[model samples]
Target: MIREQATDKRTLKTIRYDADLIVVGGGLSGVCCAITAARAGTRVVLVQDRPVLGGNSSSEVRLWVLGATSHMGNNNRWAREGGVIDELLLENLYRNPEGNPLILDTILLEKVVMEANISLLLNTAVYEVEKSDEETISGIKAFCSQNSTLYDLVAPLFCDASGDGIVGFQAGAAFRMGAESREEFDEKFAPTAEYGELLGHSLYFYTKDTGRPVRFVPPAYALDDITKIPRYKRFNAQEYGCQLWWIEYGGRLDTVHDTEAIKWELWKVVYGVWNYIKNSGQFPEAETMTLEWVGQIPGKRESRRFEGDYILKQQDVVEQRTHPDAIAFGGWSIDLHPADGIFSEKPGCNQWHSKGIYQIPYRCLYSRNVTNLFLAGRIISASHVAFGSSRVMGTGAHVAQAVGMAAALSARHHLLPRDLTEPARMQTLQQELLKTGQHIPGITLHDDQDIAQTAQLSASSEFILTELPPDGPLLPLTFSAAQMLPLPAGPIPQLTAFVTADRDTTLTVELRKSSKPFNHTPDVTLETKTLSIHKGKQEVDLTFDSHIDEPQYVFITFLKNEHIQLQYSQLRVTGILSVFNKINPAVSNYGKQEPTEDIGVDTFEFWCPERRPAGQNMALRIATGIQLFSPANSLNGIQRPTNQPNAWVSERNDPNPALTLTWPTKQRISRVELSFDSDFDHPLESVIMIHPETVSPFCVDEFVLCNDRQERIFHKTDNHQSRSTIRFAQPVETSSLTIHLKTNHEKAPAALMEVRCYSVS
Candidate 1:
């Protein structure tokens, strides 16, 4: 084949695309936004500057995705961010439990490519913005270096999720780059100039043992002195990736314009750190290790935050504010870092957590100045203090999922983003999000069209939590431990646990509850009982004269005692966990949390559960049962455990557990949605961490959907998702529907969180 040569001043291949909505950036937030919108039937064009879909979470960056759950360092229980992000995380856990970033890259790419309504452009950076008016972005111009082509993408609406706010910047969207003063929002925790104005960019590296001695050489640009880093002495050959999250820089510089310079500095530091490890003789383990990978780009923590109708401030997070137009939620702690980064003498970060998850209003999602533009990811209209909390990838992705649904609604009604903030429209938006398994605090599903809402529901069996049999291993009380129990609104029951004491040690047990019912912080102590224990194993009576006003989780705490060992049970329930008061340096939780100063942060003891294959329930029994699981709970709208166990759990011995929904007349249903217990409390970090299992033990792995005639409608197996939407080929008319469910693992009892039916999907 012969090709003709172009004349002087020849143009590159230019292409134009049109879509109903255009999303800039292909990070978790943007990718989730595009996927959600596409699922809602909105034509979408996803433009990403990088080659892969996930931004900081990509193989290139190697940062784990975390949000509420806070690495299980906080009190939020069953609080994992859901929807497309949950599906992706679960899939990653199934396919790559080892957390190879490359496998995650493929998962992200596959998700985007599978959507028929999405058009993705990789390695393409937007350079120009075209506006239909002063406030509306009509189109954008981008160039793909790998393809040597230019693209013009136009859409009715635009979403700026490009971590750096590039599109919003070019479109004249109002934004703030630095932290607001303490006086501005009465944010006592706001950083002073001495600390830092903006959070910095972080770099990470991985090391591998080569089985034999390996040699390493530093590049010319490598950092010659690792001592320049104040925390350099803390490094170890065993730790890598996020464990070294403090290797940050560039908060003092222009995070956007000087990104290249910042990257270079990070590269120098990473290489130098590796060089010191290889040749410094401090780490003999490094003799058989080599630098496997180093992040080419830094994971950004802060940038230009675009302004919306409402700027989420510190009070909104601290108070757990309820918004009238609530559409999303966040539970990550307000974490801020010093601008000096790794070189600073101060600690790496300052984090403060809230009592519970807070609602994110729809008003904070769209730009006030840029009418047609929506702000997502970390760039949303959150003040510096609030951004410190809502900036995590899972939170941002969940928020952007709402943005996606909003875009789809806007397109369907031919309206703008602002119009969706109306009372009626906002309720509809919240309902839609809940239907998709999105956990919006204080909101429950209220779909008038869901026929199941009017049907008579019954279950084969309802679990009555009486005891956790002492059938597993015993764990040493190296840390203060607590058994989380869901109790009714009455007198607290007497408890008992099997414990072995090495000596005649005094054991302290405290009955406590959270200041708020939904919170698990155990801030309010009801009673304390000190018992004298002899050396041998014995059943200790933990009878404390305690009473509660409402149904809430009561923490039966056993103080740390090296002389005692507590019994663990193999039995696992949908919403029960045993937590330990210990330190997780990553989140800065050192059991008891207290601010260095009076920074309006609460001081409390952290009671977080350990990752599974470990965190088994304590062997305990209550003479009076906490009858929480009922058939009616399956229709209560709330899908996850909150102040109470809001699920219909069957008895462990029940051979066949099933739910039946009966209608007075034959009903034509197009779709049936089921929400199961997927252990929402577990933080499904997608990279750099190994997950214990692919599917949740509480998930219904096998289920049968049948019509009134007992005719099988759909039989599903190996179901691992939190939400399962079953759509019939055609409308199925039936007077009754029965769902036979089976648990994913024998350790967990069969549980159903919610069941909803719709005439129109």
Candidate 2:
């Protein structure tokens, strides 16, 4: 409410703020967007309409923060998201294992406030937009109802991470609402006819036992009839949290404009459902349970999707397309729901996953119509089908991270959002992201200033890759195609495969080089071998004269024969991966019984029906004469193990083991970052419902950093974090650096992902 001091221009006063970036919304994506830009030295103004942060994942909504790992249930193989969100997840894992939404709200708020470059405005809703033109948003006017203050926020660049694209809509940016027709984007998942109905919103409630008999009296709005509810049979009194993501509504109406109406409907459904559980004759065990918390706000699924230069389609995700300017990656299934939501008689949602992780181009992050505006989170440029996959909070966090880095780069270079899409600039942006521990899946970091690339790398111990660890049950790889695997730079002696043939048959396995490393497509056949196998489970071996001179790729392909089947492991392998036939129809949740390998696990092309012999390699192995473990492997830019377990360890006999990196010339360094082993092989659950007897810990307890002159520049005697960064007060020049470590209390051997040094510019 702005009061005019006087009619004359001389008596007018205004409250205004200027920042490098303005982020609208305090959701997970917006929080990451603002924090990333601010951390990279950009002034940001973060505006959230709610007093509490974390839009959908807040206490008001209470949706779990899901990402590529998919709650550690989807075994997409080493697909956890890193960077700012990773830090939050790791911290939450340590602090709030119970997965309390209130704790998460404090975590998000504290993260935003700790950044000195960010100005946070909670309970402020931006309703007015002042644009320089149709193509640029110059500023915005927001009202903080709590404080009764009017805010004028101006910035060079703006991001609409509000999940509804409100800023982009106000700025007149091109956008689409609801679902598209099948022919629109040639999307198989789209509806046959174009419809205005979109995926609905969800409301959740938490119920806990009071340790004694409790009675619940239905409120006036409580639902009475249980026969109308189709999912009543699926309800369990003990279930809470995101297990109720399907208690949704309001897809038939505008999710944004009719939010209040939708919330009311959701509230009715919630209380009604609870009444059926406690008051209805069907439930007796719920007598001791009482409603603890229920959501006032609904967690939305889809609304207005802003148009970018390129719109991601279902094919892009299913095909796992690798973009030239890929800035992010998503692995969640393409999950879409019916417009009627909970009212729909059919299943609530349908989903389809990719063969492997897919890439998200930078072109899909900024607006095609609004030059100065950027978009992240659920509102990014994607068709409804594509949005189904990228809508998850973890994937949205990745999108926000890219937008933040791009915002920082744009602010520093005096370039617009679209201008940063140039190849060189985009590459630099990717390098910066990787430097900050955001894994881009396919992209490799090449920093010329990194002295480790030219240093004489030596470690006290190295992890030797001699045999494959026990693997999960194998399925038949009988399709008329082949499976692929990558070999280290070493010699290959005899290739082995476990198989059970219906009859005596000859099997041919070809070794080739992969043309595309991301897709793992075999290009040329380097060697071929044919072996005869019997009917029972037996070991089949083929000798090949192939030697990998450099860190190149070697793809393994087994000629398809219906009678001949390749034997694979029954136990799931943690860090190693193999690509199976692409043309074969995907088996949804092939091995759902295994907790570590559940639904969305089949998204990767690594499953085969053939079972491997016990104590044998899962599929194949090499008695490489060449050394697999060396100091050089640590700085090869391959951080997390995807296809193989890679690391350098010290000899067990050595009294003092350390890794020393020495360069030819001294270099100015400002920061040293270390990524230690977090036991990627053993999976951890985000929502722990059942307490386990033991947990695996992978963080180093203590470490010391010394320069070439033996002068201690940084030392941490008490470290329990997976990723650690030591920034010197001022840049220190050094030719060599060494890390002395104290073994973890758990007695697990020391393992690391990467050790990187950076010169702050």
TM-score of each: 0.97, 0.82
The digit string of per-residue lDDT tens for model 2 on 532-575 reads 77776777666778776655445666777888756554322223
Worst 10 residues of 2 by lDDT: 608-617
Instruction: Please give, for residues 1-761, the per-residue lDDT of candidate 1 as tens digits.
Output: 97988877878899999999999999999999999999999999999999898998999888899988899988778878888888898888879988899999999999999999999999999999999989889999999999999999998899999999999999999999988989988899888875677878888999999999999989999999898998899888988997788888987888888888888998999899999899999999889999888888899989899889999998898788788988878989999888988889888988888877888888888988888898889999998999999999999999999999999999999989999988888888889888888888888888888899899988888898889999989889999999999988888877789999889998999898999887888999999888999998999987877788888999999998999999999999987889999888778888778878978777887889998988999999888877999888889989999988899999998899999999999999999999888888889888778887888888889999999998999999888888899998999999999999976578788999999998843
Clash counts per candidate, in order, are 1, 23
Give lDDT per model, in order: 0.90, 0.72
The deviation in Å at residue 375 for candidate 2 is 0.3
- Which candidate has the top score in TM-score? 1
True-structure RMSD for candidate 1? 1.7
